[model samples]
Target: MNIPSLPPPVTRDKNALVLFSGGQDSTTCLAWALTHYNHVETVGFSYGQRHAVELEGRPRILEKLRQFSEKWNRRLGADHIVDLSLISHLSETAMTTEMEIRVMENGLPNTFVPGRNLMFLTAAAMLAYRRDLNTLVGGMCETDFSGYPDCRDDAVKALQVALNIGMDTRLALLTPLMWKNKKETWQMAFDLGGQKLIELIVSETHTCYIGEHNRLHEWGYGCGKCPACLLRKRGFMEYQSEKKPI
Candidate 1:
């Protein structure tokens, strides 16, 4: 798949709160926010995901990120974790349950937790409002992803508008990875913080849906078969190939 050229980085003099999940994409977004914003904070949701191991990796990733540079250490701010376990009660999708990962009759994956991203963004927006952060950053992407309707660009943009109008405040919802494929996402982490960031991501970040973190893979700690793991593995392979001699 041909990934489109990334737009120029958007710098904000104020602050941004990233919707961080301690996965590859969210880790990259946190780095991007630290690089572009004056102050960067992170917010994670505890929605009783089967892969809740990612939650444990959050602080470890953040601490390691602080060591990347003095500037980032200074810019990185407090981290917030929201208790959204209600999602498990509200939905019985594969993400919140132990059901086999398969396609539903409606054509969407059983992994598609209904309104997961929507609730995430809404909660993040509310947190941003309280924290006085004007910008909201997330790793949501339409390219190289599961066919989740919520991850689509249109849905995110509409939610952004709704969020701002409902709150009566101008909040900039930024999806830096909205168009980039997983390969391009790998490149993005490299661009933001180089090899060290990539190493940290591969060693520390968690992306497995089945909560497998003890078994490590070249791309990261995953089962290397789930949709999330497969995507990450494929992207890393492509990224490595691109860096090789022609």
Candidate 2:
């Protein structure tokens, strides 16, 4: 999709911000930012959704990443979790409401939270503006997403433009996973560093809609039935298959 380009690249001196949820994709994006940017901070959102447990995992993920930074001699900035529970009250979908998951007439799943990504990017951009940061990173993947309109590259591009104009600041919003699938996402985390980053992602992140982390799987621990868990497991299987010796 042809979308608007971002603001000019900033100097390497400025910090980069990642819109973190401590989920699979976001974790990979965080690791990607850590590799490319010298200074990286994470910002999470608590919207009172059914899977709010993911928010709690943010710190754990950051802690593990910080340990990796120490070993790898990299620098990490502070992590912040913002309270946006009002967003939950604003939408009634499977993510925030007690309803069965189904595909809407527009081909979107019930888990689709209207403007969630838009709000997240906008909030992250504002935070970056105040912190004197020139880049914002996120993990929105349209290829392996649950039909979220906001996850589309075009949508994010439009929002990036709107945010720059509204905030009157030049910021580049980067989606490292924009063109990647779930399997590619796993490969990305591994390629960014090594197997240790992949292990941290599986052991420290949460992606289940039902918040089931006790059950173990090749990808991670999840309920094994929800959309998130299914996609993760499938990706892990594909990744393993590709890595197998013929």
Q: How does each model score on TM-score?
A: 0.94, 0.94
Choose the strongest candidate by lDDT: 1
Residue pairs in candidate 1 whose N, alpha carbon or C atoms collide under 3 angstroms: none
What value does the lDDT take at residue 21 in candidate 1? Answer: 98
lDDT of 2 by residue, 1-246 (tens): 687777666575856999889898888888888887778888999888887778878877787787775732366887887888998889888888777778899888889889998988888888888888889999888899788889999998888788888888788988899998888988888888688988887787889987777877778878888899989989988887897453
Model 1 lDDT per residue over 1-246, tens place = 232322323444678999999999999999999998889999999999999999999999999999989999999999999999999999998888887898889998899989999999999989988998888898999999899998988888788778866998788888999999999999999999998999999999998888889888889898888899999999999999997453
Clashes of 2: 0
| Local error of candidate 1 at residue 158 (angstroms) | 0.4
